[model samples]
Target chain A: EPEVTQTPSHQVTQMGQEVILRCVPISNHLYFYWYRQILGQKVEFLVSFYNNEISEKSEIFDDQFSVERPDGSNFTLKIRSTKLEDSAMYFCANPEGVGYGYTFGSGTRLTVV
Target chain B: AQTVTQSQPEMSVQEAETVTLSCTYDTSESNYYLFWYKQPPSRQMILVIRQEAYKQQNATENRFSVNFQKAAKSFSLKISDSQLGDTAMYFCAFMRPSGTYKYIFGTGTRLKVLA
Candidate 1:
């Protein structure tokens, strides 16, 4: 099974500061997704990326959030201005295409102070 | 839009015993997939089992299996001979077969396997 690696297993940042969460996808996989789980809550879809562009996104993915595959290897989620409520565990996932399961990163736990 | 519902917030079973977690989803699409993902304390999403809507046979993986009732819109996971390592949060998810294939996850059921 292919693995997706997430950086900074844990991060603590001040409210209103910009934060970038990075995910390293498998070299051959083209579709990727970002999801966040607030403490004690269900995991929510943030956005999906395909072929170096945004394919779709949920209402939770506001203008404050942006995703890109800079350099075509590392996929990143950037929060323009983090709020206290933005603290959660963010996971990056890669689907093995149709009829297959998805591989998810261990997750990055973001803590806002 | 598709929605997954995990009615149980928590459950527990003695080691070597059996336990079942409940899940229900709402979707109009005829072709889709349902999945059960295990997230241990480590918080890594591990695929436990998956069921295709078109398949009548229940999906099973070792000690884990699902009773998928398509007409009832219900999918439940049954764990046999549960072990301490089985303690974790179980999430039910729904996904369409095409397009972005984004996952809609339920709130999750925290299971505790006792000694």
Candidate 2:
């Protein structure tokens, strides 16, 4: 079982501030995903990246949200201007492939003040 | 568009007893997959069980099992001889076999196992 590590286990940022959540990608996996879960709510898919491009994204992924494999090793999700509603647990996931389930990072708890 | 529904917001079961969690989904596609993920207090998503849409037989993992009714579009999880460690938020999810393979998750059922 490979691991997807997320940095800054917990982050606190002021509203309107820019925030970037990082995920260390698995060496051989090409598909990566970002999901968010508000406190006591269901987890929702944000976006999926494949071969260095956005493959699919949900409506929740507005202009404010962007994902990139900036250095080919680290996958990052950037929120241009955070809102109080953006406060949630952001998780990075790597799917082993078809039929195999995903491996999710412990998560980054983003707190917007 | 695919949606997973977990009608039970919370449930409790006594240790060593059996309990079942219900899930229903709406999808037009015939080929897909269903999953049950357990999120503990730590908030790590753990895969509890999976069932392929085409398979008629139920899928099970140790104490966890799924009764997948493809015709009814219903997937239910049954835990036997439940343990205290089973306390967590259980989310039922749906995934397409192709495309981006992104997951559509239900709100979740918070289960508590009492001693």
Candidate 3:
């Protein structure tokens, strides 16, 4: 089965540095998303991308965060400045289409020190 | 807003026994979708099963099935003949039925299969 793939399975960055997490969604998938889970918190939605634009985003998705589908296959999430609280597991998911269940990638564990 | 709650933070089951993880949600929309996802030690999110709120009949996938209660706004997962490999963190998710956006995930329930 085809799967969503994320690069840099684990990343370590300084508090003020920028980090960009990358994801390659399933080739035929139309919708993509980024979600983060704090050590013991719920998985929260960051943003959803479709047609090269942000379709939806949650309150947690603030000025510090931004998502871009630079090309047809690559989706990226960039954090301007990392904070200690930014440490968490970031998952990238893709659904066949809208309203369908999403297939999640292994996840990239971001450690902001 | 829609929210998913998994009250049980942790659960354990004998290797050969059956186990059920509880999940409840609050949603105003009449039509939507519910899902069960598993995350093993590898941290890979895997789809366990799914149900359409409009469908009254329960949805089952092999030993993994769901008891979807539309009236009570509850969707629980039942794992039968549980095995050691079944140990993982289980998450119940809610989504829009029209295929519009991302999902709302529960805090998650960690399941351990004892040998």
TM-score of each: 0.98, 0.98, 0.96
Residues B67-104, candidate 2, lDDT per residue (tens digit)? 99988999999999999999999999999999998999
Best by lDDT: 2
Q: List the residue pairs that clash in candidate 1.
A: none
Candidate 1's displacement at residue A17, Å, is 0.6
lDDT tens digits, residue span B5-106, model 1: 999999999999999999999999998999999999999999999999999999999999999999999999999999999999999999999899889999
**Residue B104 shift from truth in candidate 2, angstroms:** 0.2
| lDDT (C-alpha, whole model) for all candidates | 0.93, 0.95, 0.89
TM-score of 2: 0.98
RMSD of 1: 0.8
Clashing pairs in 2: none
Off by over 4 Å in 3: none
Model 3 is docked with a DockQ of 0.74
lDDT score, candidate 2: 0.95
Candidate 2 regions exceeding 4 Å error are: none
Best of the candidates, DockQ: 2
- Would you list the rank order by lDDT, best first? 2, 1, 3
Each candidate's DockQ score against the native complex?
0.82, 0.85, 0.74
